[model samples]
Target: MVGKTHFIGLMSGTSLDGVDAALVSFDTAGPLTGELVHTAYLPYPEPLREQLLAIHLPGHDELHRAALLANELSRLYSRAISELLARSAMSAETIEAIGCHGQTVRHRPDAGYTIQLANPSLLAELTGISVIADFRSRDIAAGGQGAPLVPAFHAAALRHPTQHRVIVNIGGISNLTDLPPSGKIIGFDCGPGNLLMDAWCQHHTGQLIDQAGAWGAAGTQLPDLFNQLVAHAFFSAPPPKSAGREEFNLGWLDSHLTGTESAQDVQATLRGLTTYGITHAIETHCPNAHEVYICGGGARNTALMDSLRAALPGKLLASTEMLGVDPDWLEAHAFAWLARQTRLGLPGNLTEVTGARHPCVLGAIYPA
Candidate 1:
C-alpha cells in the first residue's frame, strides 16, 4: 500500500471539549515511527457545550439536535485541520487522511455497541481527505470493550522491551496500558478520570475544568463516600471493559452525590476515586512497572499529579515529556496511527487485551 508522510487525527473526547486536531508525520509502513508534529485544541463554543450537556442522558431533543451538531462537528473538525495546516505552512493537499474519533455520547461495550458522535463522511468531504472513524463497534461485535483501544497504539508507539511500563490515559474516563517486560500487552478503562472531576468543576465554578485541581486540593476525600463510589462494578470488573460518559456522567454524579455534599467535597472525593482506582490497578496488574507515563487531559491537573504521586509512592510518575511526546496529543496521535492501520487493513486490537475472538482491523473508511 502506498503511504503518506502526514495525517490529521481528530479527537473530541467525552469531556465535550472542542476537537483536538493533531498533525501527525510518519513513514506509515514497515515499523511504525510517527510523531504528532503539531497540535491544537479548539474549545467547544459555549452554546455547543450546553447543548451536549443538555441532551446527554435524557435524549429529549438531542437526537434531532445531535444530527445538527454532528455536521457542525464535522465542520469544526475540518476547520481545525485547515487551521492546523495553515499554521504549519501546509495545505489540505498535503495530508494523507483524517482520523476522527467523533464525540462519544454512549459507550456500552457489553450491549455490543459503542457510539461516537460525528459525521466522518461529511468531514471527509469538507477536508478532502480519506477519513477513518467508527473505531469501536468492531471490537464490541467481537465481544470486547470497544473502548480503550488506544492501548494498541500505546504498545506500538510507546512501549519499551527492557523497561516494564504503564501508559495511563486519564481522559474523561481513565484507562491504562500495561506493557510487560515480555510481549504481553493488557489494558482497560480503570474508572472515571477527568470526566467526573470536570463536571463538578463546571457546575460549581463555571469553568470547563478544575485548573491545577485547585478546588480538590482545598478539601479532603470523604473516605466512606470515596469507597461508595469505587464500589462501582466497572472498578471490580476484569479487563476488556470500556467506559465513557454513559457509565460515569453528570447524572451519575447527581445519583452519587445525592444532595449530601458540596460540589467541592464531591470533586475532592472524585479526584481521590480516580487516583485510588489507578494506583490499585497498577499494583494489581503491573506491579513491576518501572514508571507510570501519564497522558491525556488529566495530566494537566497539577494537584491530580500530586495525588497520583502520593498514591504510588516511590514510583517515578511523570508525564509523556520524557518519552518525547506531549501528554495532550497522545490520544489524537493514536487515532492518526489507527487511520494508517485502516488504510493498510491492519489489526488494531490485541486479542489478549480486548478479548476479541480474533485480532481484527479497526475503523471504517470514508471517501474524500
Candidate 2:
C-alpha cells in the first residue's frame, strides 16, 4: 500500500449506451491522484440496450429478468476490462481491483434503496481480479440520495485552491459539484441530460444519438415547451437530490407535448431544457464560481455546450480535459478511485454533498 497501485473502473451510465472502462494508477502515501494508464469502451448491442431500458420500469418477471441481465452485464463488463488490460499490454493480476458502477435500472433514494445491477462475483471470476461494486447503497442507508457520488471524486481531482470551480457532469442525467475555495462541497442532480434527447432522437430519426446534436441544432427551441420541461419539480428542489429515468423519461416528455409540435422543435426544446438546467444550477448555487468544467457524454453535444456558454456569460466554460482528465472517461476513472478508497478503508462519500449522516466507505468487495 505504500507505492502506486493500479485499478480498473467501469461505468454504464443512464444513457444506457455501453460500458466505459478506465485503468488508472494511484499513489497510496499522498493526496489522491489518479493517473490514467488505459481506457476502453464497449457499446451494448441493440437487443441488450433494449432489455436494459425495459428493466428500468415495472414489468413482468422482472426479478428473473434482472438476474439474467446482471450476469450478462458482468460478462460485458469483464470484456471491457479485458480490452483495457489487453490494449495496455497488462494482465488481470496487475490490477488491484475493478470498480464497476453497474447498470442502474432503478435509483429511488427517497425510498431508501438504489439498485445497480451487477454480478461482482461473476465479474471477479471472469476477470481474475478483485471487484468492487454497489458503491451507493451505504450512503442511501445513511439517509442520502445515493446518486451523484462522483462529487467526492470531483473534489479530490478537480478542486482549485483559490478559485471557486464547478464541475458539471452531463450524462443521461446532469449533476454538478461546487468546489469552493473554502467551504463544504455541494453537489446534486441538476436534471435530465442526454436521456430524453437521445430517446426522442431515436424515436423520430432512427439514430441512437443526435450526433453532435446536429438535428437539434438545426431546429428552433419552443418557448412554451422549454418552460414546461424546465418547470419539473426536480429542477426547483433543493440540493442533496438526485434524479434518473424514473423522474425524466419519454413518458414524462410525452405528457408535456401536445402531439402537434414539430419533431425537430421538440428535439431543440429538449436540448434547451438540458442547457437551462445546468446553467440555472450554477447561477443559483455557484454564482461566484470562477470556472466551469463539463464532463460526461453530454459534453460531446456541441449544441448543448454552445447553449451553456451562451447562457452563462463571463464564466469560463470548458471540458474537464482542461484539468487533465478526459471528459468522456472521468466517471469511469472515479469508480477506480472509489475502489481504492474502499480497499484503503477510507471514507468515499462527502457528507455535506450527499446529505448522509456522515461520510462512509462505499462499495462491496468480491475477492478473486
Candidate 3:
C-alpha cells in the first residue's frame, strides 16, 4: 500500500493524562488496513491541566475561561503534531486530515448535548492540515449517547471470526465493546476507572497517578464502601450509556464516605469498584466472551489487572498489544479511523452501540 493517504489522529481522554498523536496509513486497494507508522505523546502542562479540571465544575466566568482553555489545547495539539511529524520525517503537506478528539469538558446526552473543548479551526490554521472534530454531536443530534465510539473500530480492527471478545478501555472512565462471534456489536461506559482513585491519590499523596496501583495494593478494600460505590444506578442501567467526571468525581466519593476510613483503604476500594464494574458488565452482558482485551491507562495498573484476572477465572485477559495494537494508542487510532470515515462520507456511528436512530457519518470538517 505504497503512497497510501496518511491521516493523523489526536486524542486527549477524560483522564487529563496527555495527548496522543498517531500517524496512520490506509490501503485504498482493498478493505481499510490501518498501519500505525508513528506515534507521540504530549503531557498537558500543570497550569493547563488545572484549568481544564476547574472548568469541568461550575465556576466564575466559565464561558470566558473555557474559551481560553480551548485555544490552549489547540496550541498543545499543534505541538503534538509537530513532534509526530518530526519523528516520522513526514511533512504536513503529505498528510490528509487530522482527527482530533478534543478534551471532553462536559458530556450530557440525556440533556441533549455533549461538549469537547478544542478549537479545531485554529488547529487547522496552526498545522495547515484539514481537521475533523466534533465527532459526537451528530450522533447526539440523532438521539444517541455519542460515546464509546471506539467499539465500531474494535470490531473492525480487533474482532475475530470465531471468538467472542470484549475490548475494555480504562481511562478516567471505563468503557467496553462486545464483539460476538456473529451478531451486532454492543458497548457502553462501565463507570469510573481512574477518575476516583487518581483524584484521591492527587489530593492525599500529591502524585499525578498511582504508579502500578502500588498505593492501593498496600491497603485493604472496605467491602461496605465497595458495595456502596457499585450501587450507583449507572452500573445497572442498560447499554447506550456513558459517564464522565460530572457523575463520578471526588465529590461523589466524598458523599459516600463516613469520615472514619483511611485514605489508603478508600483508594483500594476505588480500585475494587473499578474492577467490579468492568467485570460485572462482562459477566452480565457478554459471559461467552473468552478473551478480554484491555486498553487505555488502566492497562498498566498491575493491581487492577491482577484483580480482574482473579475475578474472571478461566478467561484470557491481555492488553491490545497482544493483538498487534498498542493499548496506549488504540483510542487515538480510532479517532483517525473516524476521521477517515468522515472524509469518505461513510457512516461512523453504530446505532446499536450508541442508540442513535441510525448510523450517521460523524464529525465536522475544519478545512485548512
Q: Which lDDT values do the candidates have, in the order given?
A: 0.84, 0.92, 0.93
Worst 10 residues of 2 by lDDT: 25-34
**Candidate 2 pairs with clashing backbones:** none
Cα displacement (angstroms), candidate 2, residue 336, comes to: 0.2
- Candidate 2 — what's its lDDT? 0.92
Per-model TM against the reference: 0.95, 0.98, 0.98
Error of 3 at 265 (Å): 0.8
Regions more than 4 Å wrong, model 2 = 28-31
RMSD after Cα superposition, model 1: 1.7
Report clash pairs, candidate 1.
103-117
Instruction: Answer with 1 or 3, whichever has the higher TM-score.
Output: 3
